[model samples]
Target: MKSTSTLLAPEEEFPTALSELPVLEIHVLHSRVCRQLDHEYLTDPAGAHPVTLDRHHELVAELDDRDAA
Candidate 1:
C-alpha cells in the first residue's frame, strides 16, 4: 500500500501576483491634484482652496484593492 505521508506533503507557497504590481506614478497624482484644483476654482472663484489628501488616499486604496483582486 502507498504511504499516506507522501500524499499529505505540503505544497510550496509561490509569490503572490500582487508582488509584481507596478508603483504608482507621481505625475498622475499631480494631475489628479490639478484637476481637483481646477474643479474647485470653477465652483468658487474666490473661496479658499482645500487640499485633498483624502482624495489621494482613496485613489491609492482603489489601486491596492485592484492589485489584490
Candidate 2:
C-alpha cells in the first residue's frame, strides 16, 4: 500500500495536534481509524450512530467550501 504521505504534499498543513508527528505516522493513524469505522459499520450498519456521521459530513463540506474560497 502506498503510504499516506504519498496522498498529501509536503507543504500541507496538518491539524495542530498532529504537527509533531511525521506525516506518515498521521496517515497511518487516519487509515487505522477509517478501517475500524468501516468494520463497525459492516458488523452493525443500523447499530452505528448517524448523528456523528452527519456532523462529520457537514464539517467536511464546510471545510471544503472554505478551502475553495
RMSD of candidates 1 onward, in order: 20.1, 9.5
Clash number for candidate 1? 0
- Best candidate according to TM-score: 2
Please report the TM-score between candidate 1 and the true structure: 0.35
lDDT of 2 at 65: 54
Q: Write the per-residue lDDT of candidate 1 for residues 1-69, one digit (tens) a residue.
A: 123221111131212332343444433443454465555557776732433444444445656676698
Task: Itemize residue pairs with steric clashes in candidate 1.
Answer: none
Model 1: ten consecutive residues of lowest lDDT: 6-15
- Model 2 lDDT, residue 13, Cα: 38
lDDT of 2: 0.46
TM-score of 2: 0.41
Worst lDDT run of 10 residues, candidate 2, spans 5-14
Candidate 2 residue-wise lDDT, 1-69, digit = tens: 344542222233334444455556554545544454465477775743454344334434544555586
